[model samples]
Each structure stands twice: as structure tokens, then as C-alpha cells.
Target: MDVRLARKYTVKLSFEEIRLPPFEDILILGKKCPQGRIGVFRSFDFLVPNEFESYEVEDKSVEAVFINKRVLKKINNEKIIEILQERVFPYVSESEIIKVDFKMTIFYDFIEGEL
Candidate 1:
């Protein structure tokens, strides 16, 4: 029997306003910092696509955020965004965060074996 799973995630975060460098150039995030930052010796490994847009929402608390809605389909790897809340959310500072919300939709397809 084969099982297939499809998952979609929409993660929205609101934080203190900060100006980020434009995507025209590669951003070496956390490579060098004075202190209290993720200043690891190794270069950071995250790719920001040029297609992102900065939005102006009605809420005023948000400064900068990434509103990503993605769909992932796999045979066994069903939990994509669920794991991120553990690995990623820890890096966010409480003082900088205004709101964090997730919208998830899942679909399951079951196949029966033939006699």
C-alpha cells in the first residue's frame, strides 16, 4: 500500500520594523556582528528570491515580515511546516514579535489493495 500526503502552509509573522537590504544583492546574514547576533563563523545559508514584495497592511505593529504560502507533496514526508515552528521560531525575540499565525490545509488520498 502507498500513502500520499499533501500539505500547505501559510506562515505570517509580525515584528518590529527594520529595514532590510534589497534582494538585488546577496545578503550575508549573521556572518559578522558585534554581539548578541547569530554571528557564526560560517556564512549563512538562506536564499531569498527576488519575487518577494513588501506589503502595507492595516495593522501598524508589523514592520517586516515574510508571508509565505507553500505546498509540499510527498509520500512519507508529511510534516514540513510543523517542524519549522521548533527549529525556526526559537530565533525570534519576544520584544520584536507582534503576532505569529499559521494557516495549514492538508489533504489525504487513500488507496485500497486489489484482491
Candidate 2:
């Protein structure tokens, strides 16, 4: 009888700065996401107090949307909801949590004595 043993191991390591709240401007939680809206909200509230706002969506795929309050300042709530439903909801699933890097650009025109 002969016995032979061989073992090989490969390891990879990477490191990056930890991002607070682990997300950017938006966090979209599906209906069946692992973490409920309240838990997620609490975590965000603790990390960045009064910075994020959560809202429930009426769509079947999306459970809720957590948007930065600063974003709300730039865009209205109704418009935000409308954009999510029209663009993002169709790609989301009931059991998924999605992180969105939202960006807003504003334009303004001013003329002297045009009030």
C-alpha cells in the first residue's frame, strides 16, 4: 500500500478604505431583501444622523428607497419616486438590495431685472 498527499493553497488579499453607510446617495431595498427598511434606516441614522431619508415605494419589485436628504433638496420627492419607478424598478428584484450612486445636475438662467 502507498499513501501520497498533496495540498496547494492560493490566497488573494485586497484592502480599501471603509465607506460609511456602505453606500452612496441611494439604497434601494427590494420587498424580500435580507434587511428590512427599519433596520437599514436605523443603521444609516446612526452613521450619518439626519442625512438620509427613507420612503416606501408602491412598485411590486422595489420595497423602499433610501435617499440622501441632500438629494431631496435638489429634487422633489415625487420626482424622485417617479424616476425610480420609471427607470430603476424594472431592473430590480424582490430579494435584492441595490446601491445607487445618484448624481444631480442643475441649470439656471438669470437676467438682470427679470424678476
Question: Against the true structure, whose lDDT is highest?
Answer: 2
Cα lDDT of model 2 by residue, 1-115, tens digit: 3344565679999999987988878889999998888989888878998988889988888889999888898998889889888888899999999888889898879756755
- Evaluate model 2: give its TM-score: 0.83
- Summed over model 2, clashes come to 0
RMSD of each: 22.5, 3.2
Local error of candidate 2 at residue 105 (angstroms): 1.2
lDDT of 1 by residue, 1-115 (tens): 4344565679998887553322221111221223212221111223334322222222222223333223222211124323434544445443343223334556869867899
* Candidate No. with top TM-score: 2
